[model samples]
Target: MSTAAEVSQNNNVGPVMRQGELAQAVVEAAEIDNPDKIIKVEDKVAYLRIQTSDEMILKRQTIEEMLGRPFSMSEIEIELASFAGRIDTQVEYIRFYHAKHL
Candidate 1:
């Protein structure tokens, strides 16, 4: 399989993850990519996303953690299908999705 760098080839080496999933992954990446990120855990679910200017960064594993399972083929398709129409650049998009489960 292609490595993270090969996938995010245009970027500075990273996995090929979705914008929404990337938002969640970067937040879950580690404590260092933080201070700007703040997760809001409500009910039985946890919402996460990044607070940086670059929304294209993908760190796939974070999404799996949030999802609790590898996303299904249809699930991935659905998220990407609606990806562009979502215009909220400033707010936490991934968290918005996560919050729904709460």
Candidate 2:
């Protein structure tokens, strides 16, 4: 079995959000903001699992554009059911990635 550290080293990361409009907007935003990476979404009835290789970033601007209104990064916590890898959040963007060993 792979340990957490071993798994994290693979660099797969993303957000698992509750099934709703907010989750939908996140999916669209992730796709737009990370065009260089292949984004994958899995539906689990209750939530949506959105993932990407190496790293994934969701910009507030892109989400706001998808939502057609103002958005706050703090609001994402309400819909975030879980996540993979480490997360770095800012007022303008949220990033999911594995911390590289130096």
Candidate 3:
């Protein structure tokens, strides 16, 4: 487990979650994606910080698969303690990334 300070100091970007079933689901979804970007995970006693180089996405269907139950994207807001990138949510997925200007 990393201290809050250490997690914040990280230059990576992703979602932070409070400990619970939802947190577990997020981890599982990330593993399934296995993005090319470097991903870092830090577990704090009551919170978890999942970081990636630039972008990450977690789909509602994937979470449902991990949880063995139906899930709504809105549920993420309940466990989302914080985040370090731009967030885009749709009916099927949530994406975290730093936006690039045109």
Candidate 4:
């Protein structure tokens, strides 16, 4: 059994990414969300852990806008090492959040 505080503490969500250009783009895109969020990026030699509290969203459009080129959301998978929480992927955006919160 878990208390509210436990749930809150475990609510952090994001992706562990393979290091390189793709991971860099994803991390940059995460920082550019409209409502904005505090994102934490940890370098782990071969990979990077990118996380935010409660929820985080990355838009294909935003990624493209940042890169100044055509970008496919699926391309992210190439760099994704792992992810926390449930993922809702759309043509326009990808979201990570706890199912219980939804």
Q: CA lDDT, every prediction?
A: 0.33, 0.90, 0.84, 0.84
Question: Which regions in candidate 3 have their CA more than 4 angstroms from the true location?
Answer: 1-11, 100-102
Steric clash pairs (candidate 1):
4-14
Best by lDDT: 2
Off by more than 4 A, model 4: 1-9
Residue-level lDDT of model 1, residues 1-102, one tens digit each, is 898867543211122224554334444553232335443212212322222322332223444566567643234334332221122222122311211111
Global lDDT of model 2: 0.90
Q: Report the lDDT tens digits of candidate 2 across residue range 1-102.
A: 998877645656899999999999999999999999898999998999999876899999999899889899888999999998789999999999877732
**Model 3 score (lDDT):** 0.84
Best by TM-score: 2
TM-score of each: 0.27, 0.87, 0.82, 0.82
In every candidate, how many clashes are there? 1, 0, 0, 0
Worst 10 residues of 4 by lDDT: 4-13
